[model samples]
Target: MSSHSKSLGEFDLIERFFKTGANSLRTTADSAIALGIGDDCALIRPPADEEIAITSDMLVEGRHFFAGADPELLGRKALAVNLSDLAAMGAKPLGFTLAIALPMVDKIWLEAFSKGLFAASYDYSCPLIGGDTTAGPLTISITAFGSSPTGKAIRRSGAKAGDDIWVSGTVGDARLALAALRHELNLPNADLQNIAHRMHQPTPRIELGIQLRGIASAALDVSDGLLGDLRHILKQSQVDAEIQLNQLPKSITLQKQGIGIQNQFAASGGDDYELCFTAPSTQREKIHTISKILNLPLTLIGKILPKKDVEVRIHLLDASGIELSNSEAAPFLNSFDHFAS
Candidate 1:
């Protein structure tokens, strides 16, 4: 621990590092926060007819990330994951609170971490309201707030049979990076570098979520593997889904792998912070236009099906769109389970 950081108390640390102009997002009178840091409690007043959307996430050392990782990237990812939840609900970011636990105060690490945190805040226009700091094992917990028009927040329960399933951006790159890091797969330096960004600094599709409010029937952020998160929608909507393996989008880095590897990672690899949504076939043109406008690839990968006999299920299909037998899909059906050892 640095002598400078050791000399400072928690309050002093906050005043010197966090309670600065750089972290302030309330530059205008119309900002979401009525009162920011320094108060006992931050004040937020959403616009009329809008509903507040709140989400929280926690990142623990050794589990979520490796120890001695880049502080800047860790700070950014800590908040980005929560924002992804808001994006899934089609909400506009209002502000957020950060509660962090640190084993010891390191000035240099704190500086870099705060820089990355505020950078993401400014980029997303979400201000830091208030939170708590404590001494413990290194952990980052963030609670993000957002707003959407009343009755307009998209949800997993709204997906209907016949809705086309869509996924934004690419998948599998983050898992591929993890595989390389774990030595399960061998990758060149360039490939490792390319996929590492996807694992570290994932972009939350806030704009895409806002635009999809009326058009998409149901949506979610793909945090756990695509298939796993999609199951949430299926359970909520009481429906089944059929997806084509070939339609899952992939980055150039992930595409370099073999077909089995590509399929495995795309189906069950976690940490792909992309939006997975369902829309009616009639809105295909509008979705395509939105994709062009955003310059983000939105691929139709599947369709929701009626739950005839089963409670909820998924049909895995091949490149030719033929449904795979139980034997063929056994490998791809499971996803990352935190409790599964």
Candidate 2:
């Protein structure tokens, strides 16, 4: 912890740090939000004919990040991850509430963190509605709210056989950065600098997701590895997938690594907040046009298949189009699990 402000009270801290500028009040005329901060409970109504989408994400000091991590980046990431959930659902941002725990009131950290938080808030047009602040171990929990057309929000359970699986941007750079940071993989300082932002400050594909609303049969944001997150869609939709290992998009930084490392990280490395979605084969032209319009690459990595059994399976294939056995695929099967022994 940095220097502590022993005298700063809770409300005073909120007013000084969180409740100011655009966050001071809901001055902007948003029909969806009826009330904002300074109230016991903030009030929001979904837009007429639209449904609300809500999601929460928590980040702990030691588990999610290192001690004394950059407060600005951490603050941005805390909300960004939650916003990514909204993107996965093809929802439009509305607002968010932040509940934070701190060992003590570190003024410097608060200032930087709040700056970064509001920066994202402004960028995504998601205001800080209300939340709580308390004294405890360093932790950040954010609940973001969004809205989408009623009966039109994309879901994990909508994928069907013959749909094409697509991924926006690239994956595995975040894991690559983590590996280099842990010294598990040797990398140059310059390379680390280039890819560090993938882990630290990820871009949520909000526009791309909204564009994919009617097109995508199912969608999800890749936070906990591509394969692991895709499993959610498979299980929910009662389908399977066959992914070409070579087709999984990789950043130039990750491509420089050995093939084995590249496969493992791209398949199972967490913290890549890219969008992975499934769409019909007929919509290929529209999806490609969306890629051009958004300038975000949407790569077709695989296809959804009929469920073979009760088990939801994702078959992995090599460049030569040969399926790998369980033992051969083990390295890329395990994703980031918070409670694995």
Candidate 3:
């Protein structure tokens, strides 16, 4: 055969190239067929007394992430991003399917990507079930299945007026990472690297979600900006929230950057996988106890108010109950348009 004579088409590519040694994931009965890897439809059975929560996310090139993102991180993020959605619903991750559109067949790229995917899979005790490979501009779409006891899943609609608005951990690290990546501002190398890593490798709050199943009336992972996402909970829960900017969590790295003590980053910037949730005011002590037990920081940032005429307006109040509104200074809920550019 001549060096130029190449006739490996789609089917040949699938059989000869894609279906090599499998990644560390649960296969169908065939070991290689964990969920019918080659068939038109795949089937699997769920355990008794458990319901499945399925979610999908698409990471596009030159969009969701930069083109030169570490392939391993991209792969890990591809699955982790979807898992965050499941976590928001208080589901325990099971397995995931990868649908990748690649520009070419590069073994090194695949190896690194597989490492990233498997690292997270093992960490979460979830596995990769199956996937499809294709040629394109490199978009990775992952659909994940997680489980929860029947009728016990948390939802975004469960929030009620008078519930406490809470957020876990710190926020805006990922956005700060993105800003550093683009060199929009100057920062120390260590902090810059940390921020960038947060943007690339987000840790989904899976355990906390499971722990808060009964307590959280409504919950969601803050993938978008905080103001944008909390507004989502407010709208779905049909309640308004009075956000006291002083109460939001802040990272020391972020604070040192002079973002201010007002918690502006957590209030406006996004990419914090921290769960923003709502619970009745009575659950406050239990929530604090959960945080202490788990060693996770739980900050009560605000409170859900009755569906007032002034909805979606996150008030910035000072110690003396002084309210501040500065739309011109800070554009609330700008992530959609911010990323659109």
- Alpha carbon lDDT of each predicted model: 0.87, 0.87, 0.74
Q: What's model 1's overall lDDT?
A: 0.87
What is the total number of backbone clashes in candidate 3?
A: 3
**Model 1 / residue 63 / CA error / Å:** 0.9
Clashing pairs in 1: none
Across 233-332, the per-residue lDDT of candidate 3 in tens digits comes to 8788777777776667877788887645225566777677889999998899999998998788999888887885755555556546677667632654
Pairs that collide, model 2: none
lDDT by residue (57-156, candidate 2, tens digit) is 9999888888888999998999899999999999999888888888887788988998788888878888888877767899899999999999989999
What lDDT score is found at residue 311 in candidate 2? 98
lDDT of 1 by residue, 259-288 (tens): 999998998889999999999999999999
Instruction: Give the lDDT ranking, best first.
Output: 2, 1, 3
Highest lDDT against the true fold, candidate: 2
